[model samples]
Target chain A: MNITSDMIYGYTDGMILCCLSEQDSYGYAINNFILEKSGFKYELKEATLYTTFRRLEKQGHVTSYWGNESSGPRRRYYSITQEGRAYLKQRIREWKEIRQLMDAFFIDKKEEETET
Target chain B: MNMEEKIILYINRAFAGSPAAEKTEEAKEALCADLLEKYRGLIEKGHSPEAAYQATISGIGDIFELVDSVTGENREKALPSSSKILPAAESFQKWGPAAVCGIFFLLWLIRFYLAPGLLFASGLPTFLLGAVLGALGMRAFLHRNRLSFAPLLPKEQRPYQLVWGGCGLLFLAALFSRRLNPALWLIPAGAVALHQVISAWIAFSASRKEEDFHE
Candidate 1:
């Protein structure tokens, strides 16, 4: 049986919050960040990305505004709010705990026991 | 059409049945811009225009569902009351006045049949009177419901209250002045029109101010 871990495929909100934590970005730019961060293995559908944006804004975790670019079409940029940062921090802590739990459950426990 | 235009056309077609509103337009514009950017990026990566267009279009999942979810969220937020009460309230709002108008018409019909001379001697068309009264009642009902139901933002509360208050004063003045000249009834009508214009203006300016702040 072929087993693979694809935990990063979901967590669209957390990925977006992480992206915005560094700097504010627009739809395409944030998706680009996700694309690159995921080693080009995952890309969000436009619908999913924008819906997450709306959801995050509604949750007061992010705020959006129009970009005042002089040379191109106006883009709506999102920035993480203070609440978003705190939410992201909590998510990261949860992710670390989950990661540890998964490694403990899925790794070669027999080999570790023999080694000890 | 150019690639940008093609993307715009696709977006327009996707959102065709959605209600035309400011937020919908914003969503459409954002989608178009993002799709075009992605398409250009694909082209830059040596993908042919057709392939890029196909890929770009494919990346947008079920746009109708997205729009529905977004608008549905707004609908939910705009009405915090129970969902069961909405359809009942809406039907009443739509048909209650209409039913009253019908009843008034029926009464007029009976009076006409029984006392045709007296009906004509009243010097006013009873049907028109009933219709006007019914319409006024419906308007007032709708106005009241709209104000009550629409959870206004803190920024808009003041202007909304002021406009409604001013309109009420104008309405009362018009009613009192009707004793002076019957034509003064037009004052209330003018007040209604003025109220709408002022409300629309306030809404427009508020949106403009938000845009400026964002920019």
Candidate 2:
């Protein structure tokens, strides 16, 4: 609750990309998946979420199709493209490298604090 | 009109002039349902309906920014401003009716007087300039991590381009004509030239909106 909204959204593009990597899913389903996975820490604004879906689809990282929903509105489902998968893999590799570097960088500070 | 209809209309112009108009409508309805829910939530929280609706519309803040980021607009913008553009790309993107007027400004005396080395140093300047542009473009694209930038495209760019292009054309014609003063033509031509940029921008934003509402 004390965290900035930026932190929540910082991970959002990746999270959604990762979810789509599994299979094609509609707007509501993707939102639900995020909510469940994060245990409510990552509930996205409805406007924010769909806007991103539109953006991602436009970028060629993902493709969307209309779903035959019988309820409120027909869902627009999205799935990742091959290009998107490559991009995601690159991001994952980069994230891992960054994380490893951070861990190494922090160890010296951690040891200093412990000794002090 | 209800919240649903209003938001759909709001996004309608996104697909302006395209054959994909109907699909754009459907997508707007589907995508803007999120806005409808927010409208309802606002009404539930005691905000007047109009106020809530306006807030939601304004908050979306140029949906195309998100569109551009995902679509690799940055990639196109960053396409290495090389001094020597390759023969392969064949410069499909250059030139317009307004470009005819830009040729006049090639008034090389200005470039020659300012930096004669620019002719010879093309590659280095291009590389350095590219690095700077790439940085700014990335920052602009990323929002760097902000929710919104104050101004949006189309609204900011389209009309501006049309006006500038129109004036540029008009002045270029006037320059060719023997009647009007070439000097007077420059100011209007310059303004129109400025507007031409806005027009191109409008086209880009419109295309972006169309991409989101794909058939």
Candidate 3:
């Protein structure tokens, strides 16, 4: 299924936190992973990603530092903080609850339609 | 332009009016690096150079929104914990003319008391000439310091204009009162000095509150 940007809007922060949870990463690397993992079905806007990074950093959900690359311009690497981990866990639990609630309603609706 | 140049150009254009502080420049550099990396990756993945460029540029989404976010972040980071007084040079430039006028008025007062006959003979002319010079200096000072006034009244305390205008009227009144009582000349000078002090205090406090609010 093609995932729309709207579908991922609310979960962008959680996704970034999850990505950083694995290891510290830069903007392009995190986005590349997201794109590849989703089989190229999702590509985030650069502006949105950077804006999210700034917001997350400001909110103390992540911390960033300049990476020492031997060649080319320096990269900004972001790592999830303890607060980010806690926030991600809370968001995951909330997401699960929302999914369960939606599934129950949709499944009941589908069964009723099929019966009719 | 080359990919790196194009990326730098785009980012710079986006953040044109923003303060060129170290953190802001670092952020711009980071963004340029990321975009260039994305472009190179696309080209390596067998995409044509033109297609890669298109993809990378399109991925930037709304440049204005990104600029707003980045600029807002910079502003928050740059907000001072306390308001800084205007620089010595600027403060002097702003107040020097008024001080000159006060001195001239005092000189006029001294002449009036010391040599009553010489008051209009030479004192009036000297005071008038000083007043003209002071007026010209004040006009230039105000013109130069207009932008520096923005932080002083972020909420728009405009009544200061009326206070200043009243001070001018008082000075005129004092000038006319020379016939009745030359000592009355001190009244306008005192009034102007009080107005200057009060207005400066108000501006300083307003600016401090503005800084505190941002903090």
Candidate 4:
């Protein structure tokens, strides 16, 4: 089976935090950014995206406002707060450590065993 | 129908039967706008309208979680409103009367087995004790259910209340049993058994009501 969305839901907040850290953007733009960044290999469910937006806003990690669009739908735009940036940095550092540990434990061990 | 109208129809179906609220309405609007933008993006890439609509609808995943977050309805359902009663106090309120009732019955058992004809050996006090505990238990049970906004113990529960009240009076009669045969210890014991039966009935009915609520 394919890797389901739930498997990576934990990283969604971090992804959104990173996306918003670049600049203030609306729902579609942020989702599009994630889609393009993943080389169209993945896209978020709209429900998950908005749910993360609400949760992040609740946690003081992001703030949202209605964009003043004269025509069509007025989009709700979100920006990373200073707190969100700090949180994102912390998560990145933790993830890097975890990644290196996993590589040493699994990848390096497996390569060594195969060689021996 | 046009793309926008098709999307709206799909959204309506998705949110069908959800409670109408300001927050939910806002979420619906935001979701509609986001999906519309996505559908258009898909369309621009040369997908047919039907394919775009199918893709857009499927990409929505489960929308109820979003609804639950925005409305906070699920949170309220999952937890008792802390503002109304502290968790520790609420738990105490729920179990205190039953515990007291159990203790009184336990004391009566010890009295009957360990010491016959001891102080207050007629077991009249036992009946009165059961009556008072029965009343207290009823009040506490009703209060706990009320905290969760359960419908007032409906007409069906009336029979249980009446039976419980009858248990109280039986114990009240035990208060006078000292003037008669002491073998009437059997009366207090019977009333205690009836009290347990009534409590079990109430508990069973309460659990049934909760099942109905979940359904």
Clashing pairs in 1: none
What C-alpha lDDT values do all the predictions have?
0.75, 0.62, 0.79, 0.76
Please report the candidate that would top DockQ against the real structure: 4
Error of 2 at B74 (Å): 16
Instruction: Name the runs in model 4 displaced over 4 angstroms.
Output: A1-3, A109-116, B73-84, B87-215
Worst 10 residues of 1 chain B by lDDT: B147-156
TM-score per candidate, in order? 0.59, 0.43, 0.60, 0.58
Candidate 1 lDDT for residue A114: 80
* lDDT for predicted candidate 3 compared with the true structure: 0.79
Q: Give candidate 4's TM-score.
A: 0.58
Using lDDT as the measure, name the better of candidate 1 and candidate 2: 1
Report the candidate with higher lDDT, 2 versus 3: 3
Provide the RMSD of all predictions against the true structure, rounded to 1 decimal.
14.0, 14.2, 14.9, 10.5
**DockQ preference between candidates 1 and 2, better one:** 1
What interface RMSD does candidate 2 have? 4.0
Interface RMSD of each: 1.5, 4.0, 0.7, 1.1
Off by over 4 Å in 1: A1-10, A109-116, B74-215
lDDT of 4 by residue, B1-215 (tens): 57677788677756655656655676777788888998998899999999999998888888777766776743455455533565887777776766777676667667655774674645556555545666565666556555532334445556656666675566556556666446556656766687688778878987897567446
Candidates' DockQ values? 0.37, 0.14, 0.56, 0.62
Model 1: how large is the Cα RMSD against the reference? 14.0
lDDT of 1 by residue, B111-205 (tens): 75576666554323554464476666656555645544343435445665666677665654554453645756665676678678877897799
N/CA/C clash count, model 1? 0
